[model samples]
Target chain A: MLHVTTGAASGPGREPILSLRSAVFGYADRAVVADVTLDVRQGEVVALLGPNGSGKSTLVKGLLGLNSHLGGEVELFGTPMRQFRDFTRLGYVPQRHTLSASVRATVTEIVAIGRLPHQSWWGRPGRTDQRLIDRALDLVGLEDRAREDVSTLSGGQQRRVLIARALAAEPDVLIMDEPTAGVDAASQQVLAEVLARLAAQGTTMLIVTHELEALRDIVSRIVLVGEGHLRFDGTPADFVLAQRRQQDLILAHEHHHHDDDSDVSQAPGVLSTPHGPLEQPAQKRGVES
Target chain B: MNTLTTLTTLGGLPELLDYDFMRRALLAALLVGIAAPMVGVFLVQRRLSLIGDGMGHVALAGVAVGVFTDTAPVLTALVAAVLAAVLIELIRARGRTSGDVALAVMFYGGIALGVVIISKSTSSTPANLTAYLFGAITTTSNGDLWVFAVLAVVVVATTWLLRPRFFAVANDEEYARATGMHVTALNLVLAILTAVTVVVSMRIVGLLLISALMIVPNAAAQLLAGSFRTAIRYAVAIGVISSVGGVTGSFYAETPSGGTIVIVAIGIFLLASIGTSVRARVVSRRHQRAEHHPHEHGLGCGHPAVAHGDHVDYLHDGHRHAPHAGHYDEHDPRVHAQTADESETAAETTAETRSS
Candidate 1:
């Protein structure tokens, strides 16, 4: 489990860094993610939670200006994504790094792509590129493997390397889609620390994960998305409270389920006449916070 | 080895450097060397190797028509080839046939039309016929050299200017389109470049081996080079060596000049493939050993309590973490057999239950 420390507000108390207003986007005719409205404020880490086949990836892409919208608007830093690419202000860490293994690229060379927007049309990367790349490497705890081939590293290390690449761009907001998807426990911890540091630096983040239980502690806001709608949106505490209530309801049903199982064990044997009741539930729930 | 020796004997050809024949051959090879691989990088990346093949045949037909007309062959070939390329692009958009299949259809149609034109034309002569199949340096005058060099410069410059769109489409077209890049427009540009490249390189690669030049150089680069930029440079390097060697080697050998260049390029390609095979073997062996041993864990399984990421393990935890821990022994023969036995037993029970 990751320990994400929450601190006092910085800069604006509640200025939206990333916003999507009633946005609708997906394949033609059939919409996968529809009417999705979200506002991620400065210094906030929003954890999006959902079941499989959920619209998490679609919603994120629409907000990042990587996917076309059927309707509605997505604004980054108050300006719409359609106006200009705004490539410098936004950083994207895709769910999968679409790099081929045959090409031998080092961690530094890969990270240098972050400075692509800033460099002149014909200019090569200079000292500033080196400094930013080094900082990003240090941020991800992969500074020791700076010169190492990116493909030679393990899956977790590769994910960290991608994060480093995105961070090297020095964007105000970092959008990561399932950052810890294929990482070991130790690497997940390291990733959490890096994200924590970025959040502290006032970089707004929107993270998508199926691991809702683990995400509950770190997320300032939890949005439950499914079937082209924002099903639930609230603070992490409220989301947890709702989850607890759901657990109680499920537990109550579980008691009845176990009683029926025991009845199967009893079969035609009758001890019911003396007890006066046919069955009794084993667990008492809906009594605690 | 035989080809290199023949090419190196450029000095023994009775003061060949001063001769116009030697200059034309050298110029043709040098110009094609710079241009072929520059267009080749995109062709190989797009997996449209056979598009070059189709365009070459189209150019050959155009050249044949030019020969019979007693008109300018180079200009006629260039315009006709570009038109044929646009037709190939249209065919691809319709998705009726695979690119290779389309190339074969075009290739046969081109040859049949060319043969018919030559048979009927009274203008067909020994000089006209010689330059048609096996390209000759004697036909490549000073005017041809200027056209070749200018075409090469235009191809290289236009390609460099559109590098980002080229790179994006080459990597993934659907993704590129989503980013608002006009992918169809970019694809048309690549096809036009292929057409232009083949026409300019006619004197060097000729009609038969033009595709080989485009594909071979990129294949060499793919073996050892790491990035797209490095691959382009490596491919161009191999292209230059073959062009310089093939054209010069023609001064001595009885073989067709285009054949010699392609063969040299193929030799380089063969060496690169061999290197890649050895590398794959080493990589797979290490991957196998890693799979067989749990002690060789590269990283710890984040969910320690979960033995395997089966349905039950996922059900046990409230959080569904997509883990990075690679399965160690999933492919062991003994384990596989046991699993087969277990599944068979479950199947038998289900059958018995159905009967009941």
Candidate 2:
């Protein structure tokens, strides 16, 4: 439905919309993620992948100024993070499960919240806002459910409502945290299609996801994090190849130890080395591809 | 029998309105009815239903200050309540202590301070304090009505004008902040608005029972409303009915206004709860009856079958019927018309089913 208004800087050679260099994010004085360097260019769909507590969420929260920006040279739209005032350029869809169950807002009411950045403090929804809200709902295929209470919707439908809410802002980059998490397969496919449509319309996206299989066709790049560190940055094909090679190595190592009685003692070390070597081959495969 | 005789002697609603004091009390109650629940809806949405009670307690201290200083209690209460509101919000924003801890301290401290201050005052008796605590709505002066009117207007206008922003913040503070909303400022404004509501309602509903007026009607509304806006509308309606009815009943029965109003509000809440359960039963019974069918339509049954979510829906007599959990659910075609793409799938499935 072409709901997202394409930004002017949607081509190659455009300055990165979000840039983080030696960034440290945490709560209070403790750094949960440190020394991370990443750049998200215009029109690129980047999937942030990591294990639990890998600090991927912390990094995304840091970008939104939600976490403690302990030490960082983060930039949004070429403006320094601290100096950036144009938040309307970014749309955030938090985890669907995070939506408070107590709220009795309707689908339309929640979607209308996306327009707040563009609205004056005291202004009501104007004609333009309503049209955009409608288009957003249409894009997510939720136009008919606009009047229904959000709590009545299934987990997946609620996620779409959140996506529609984000899309109503017409942001330059849509940042989602585990949009597919806890969502059923059907809803995941629907979300993938919605995201793919947005990507085709030249909208930039930074999605934090563990289910890369669902978004394999849409994600342009993959960023892997482990132990609060950036571990891998490459294309989806490279990630797959690297993952296969790591599995093959583990298999070969297991075969070598099949007859050995002390294999259990060395298993932890062998598994720990896989993450370190994952980066080299993935980067090399990126060049080959 | 005594109560019935008193009611008869007091005459009707028109006779009650004949006295200036009764007129003032009713007008003040009407304003409280409108404003309290309007603010209460947001508080209830945020799950801060007891914050109003805390603000009311703090306002009691303000009334004590007013009495001790020979000033208007409403004005002093407003100042004290607004200050307490701001202080509590700042404490919450600091995140050093949890919100409920702060609320508990404020609630107990406020009433205790008010009682202590009142005990030391030689000019006013404990009876005067009782009037503020339990509410003597029948004794409302013209000056008090004017204050209530102005404060009510402020509460209504601010809430109406800023409803969207308030809802956003209350729903998801982080999302609102990410969207560049001045969340802290909005929260402060809401707290201040809540304080204003407390002061505005305290005269008619009483400081001790003001929270019930703010919360009970909204709670009742939530039982029946399908949306936030509707919940608000319903709550306001319930608030008005309860407050006005309570005031009138109290006038004839010679009972405490605050207790009467709160009881009426609770009564409505109970009725709403019962109504919701009854309606749910009726809807489920209808669904059970509609689920019956003479024939089972499935694959190779000579019916156009469309693949729905987890089951296949067979088109029979122009209605899509899907077997679900041993019952044939009559699927609404209009709900399935979510997108042209889905409808295309349904059409293709129907054609494929017929051909096979």
Candidate 3:
């Protein structure tokens, strides 16, 4: 058996691609995202979903090893995340809001940052690197725009360039944060196709977003995050089951109240719903707000 | 003109080479030229430029105390400046007040301490100690020159050896910490670098305007260059030009070398800023033309270097809010004008995913 030790951690032949245990995000002393345990297995497509300020972004950053605070342990390839320097191996398509817009780099140039760890600092990319970039661009269907200045591209196209950047690294796992935001329909379709293809090829991916319905086709599992905590984790079918159960409960309660109110209206003294017969959904006609 | 040239800026150069005063001035200025901007890059990026000014003032108090006690001024000043800088860093690390607020506190406190010491002293010459406040390049000594050379070498060596680490610190401190970087050590190093730069530049840019040398050339460089290396190149070039030109101007015009250096630097900055604006306009026009077709992503900068909404710049007013309130991150719908499906796709992604 081949044995190896990776940066302050030990692992067997097969170790987790990524893991987070009791991670917390904070500013100074106050925790913003607290005590989260999560893991992503190879070839799995998991989506982090939440409302505004629900810690999805923090969790993503933490998983990427970009967030500073973690309460317990975070690991990549069984190595302590804080000690890992090979960020390229963990292909991250960062939020569009984070990239510096003033850089005059081309689309190919942006993609090439994905190769930073593989090359020495002083060495410029050569033909082999260019070939990799070209292949990555081809994968994203943006081969024609490889050399074009990235700033001149449409919003949808820019998003493609970022994804292409991530793809260039050929990582076993990909984490895309809000990749579909501000993208066009055609571009979204292309992105979905590419990710679906990547999944078929057996690359693990974790995509975090506020909305998940559009990704239903590609994502195998759903993880709900709120208030810095993971509230749900399972297949999309389980999520659908939960949603349906909630709706059924609401409907049954409403029907029972209506029957009580009708009976009371007719019998004069039958006014009983325990707390007064769920009165007509109690919704004001013109004052719903 | 000859006398002024001889004693004004490079005022002491001949004597410095042949005598002590000129040597101190020459060595000190040379040390300043290299160290200030090199270390200043970290300070400016961290938005702690005023911290340099505060440290310089803190050193001034140390000089005053040295004068009163008849002690070696440079040693006393270094001790005081470094201590004051450490205190400022501690206050800043607490993350309670803005860096400038901490700087202001350290600034007044250092100066007051120095004044009180100076007032009580009888043996020291008030004029000699006072000159260190604004700096007197004319009175630089042989011993000071050697001290400067050693300090300069150390500053350069440390900066070069720690480039990647400092860059990580300056770029994002939080990220630096997460990546297992010794962020605390690096931050301490950065503060020390600022202290060293201030001590050296006091003879050239003056304690009153030392931050200008650190701030102006870099700001001008930022306006002109799109990358970190280019920005530093532009900044150093501006620094060199201002140093050479300011020395010449002060020699002929009979002004203080420190003041003249700052003036020349500001002139260069204004010129670069003007160039940046004109270039921005032209670039925007070209961007509009390219993007007008509606099929391209145009240029990243063609959209203007606006973050959230207002431009990515800070002011001296102490507030960090942007000028564009609601417009920040407000994308123009027509810019990409996507189909309902695409819009719904992301909206669906945001709405439907409750777990991941």
Candidate 4:
């Protein structure tokens, strides 16, 4: 696991940056992420992990207000999500490079767009904005390619350009859908180093990722979801140990059954359950596990 | 006959400046040429290039309404086009239908309704409609010129002021929304601007060919431009050249001004296609050479001209000095490091369930 000190754990007075209270969120027809209650504190790097179709991304989208809340409440920076206007305080990096290949923008131009929320109406970028943009580019090590067309860059370089764009906003809390998807191993290591540096600098981050290989070391907490429910929310080490225990239990159970002499047909006759419990079988299984 | 012979005898260009009709037509062409392509570049970038055509058809219906109700066609066309633009935006926002589908429904419906409305009006003859459809520059009034000039200036100014914001919204709407931009409002503003530009451009290129004015110049410019700013400049240049040349040629050839202008724009697009393809080949070759022969060279050197930006200051400095210059290797440690983070993030983002 990665080792990094973050502000959320270090400071006793750390405030919650975003909170979702029993939030039920989804499209018009259905609530995909239901009854989700999560609080992200300042200077914390929280990773959302889950299997496919587990509503982890949906919950994150709900927190971002991309999906409307069917019920419950969501707040950003202590204000209600709907009323929150300090967007510059929260930077967002989407899953992929959504820009079409036909776009005629350069890396600097793309990064400069991150300054939009901070800019005044009809105002161009001043010295401060330029400095922030340059700093962001420098952070991602893309300052040298600032003038190159974004389409000319490789996928990984383009991803760095996007991160630079998000960083240019100088956000207090950065929410990335997935910052390392489709990237090579070396890039992941660099990303971890950059993120480690940012964590040390006290910039909070909420990242959603499937694999915990590189990020397991940097993240302060892991929030896992399964089947639209919050399955686990704890430290990275605890989550990893619990995951290993779950696998070990399943393997041991399979081994024990294999060693047993009784056939499956005879076991079914011997182990009988009442029909009344069928309605809540999944819930019961969840509790037992 | 006398004017045509006079135009032909006196060098085919200078004598045309003496006629009032020719002067008005040329001015109208010049204004629409600059304005149409300017707005068109943004529309094309936004992937709504057909919005201009849809609005033109809507304006045609407005002209028919004006003819039927005994009102100024231009004024009524402006009103209808703006209303249609807003409607298009609303429909697009609903996400029930694709943008192109919505535009097609509007374009064909408006033109069909226009034809029906014109048939009902005794005063609206086929010849009169044909003039609106194909453009009769000789009939362009001073009032038309003034209105076109003012609207053109407004469109150009608004586009310039909101260029960066519009590009942001156009490039990645979700990102723009996350950044706290009122994306819907910006889109509405774009729609209104497109509507106004379309209606005014209709005066020169006519409804049937207005889309050509909006899309062709921008398409040609995109093939050659190094940046959006340069694209706008190139698009406007192509627009002015094509429109003015077409108008002048129409006077000498005695053909429909709008049709001639569209033809010229197509010819320019063809020429740009060749230039773009040749440049693409040269760039690929340079990339191959760089990959094979790894050497420490300045950023501006060894790279193809297309790869070098239009920044004159950078070119002057970059050509002389090598800053962090290195070999072009796909497997560079830095590249691998960058790729690892990018793919992991992408994979993670796609791993979980999404609602919308």
> How much does each candidate deviate from the true structure in C-alpha RMSD?
13.4, 6.9, 13.6, 9.9
lDDT of 1 at B332: 28
Candidate 4: Cα lDDT at B331? 19
DockQ sort, best first = 2, 4, 3, 1
Model 4 agreement with the true structure over A230-288: per-residue lDDT tens digits: 66666766565655654454455557887752333222211111211111222211112
Instruction: List DockQ for all candidates.
Output: 0.07, 0.43, 0.08, 0.26
Off by over 4 Å in 1: A1-14, A101-109, A143-150, A182-193, A212-218, A249-289, B2-7, B64-71, B83-135, B160-165, B172-188, B226-230, B272-356
- Fnat per model, in the order shown: 0.09, 0.53, 0.05, 0.33
The numbered model that scores best in DockQ is 2
Q: How do all the candidates rank in terms of lDDT, highest first?
A: 2, 4, 1, 3
In model 2, chain B matches the true chain B with a TM-score of 0.81
Q: Is candidate 1 or candidate 4 better by DockQ?
A: 4
lDDT of 1 by residue, A17-116 (tens): 7777778877555567877767666666778766656778888777655556778887878887778565666677777654445344556766766665
Given candidate 2, what's the lDDT at residue A277?
62
Lowest-lDDT window of 10 residues in candidate 1 chain B? B347-356
What lDDT is obtained when candidate 1 is compared to the true structure? 0.65
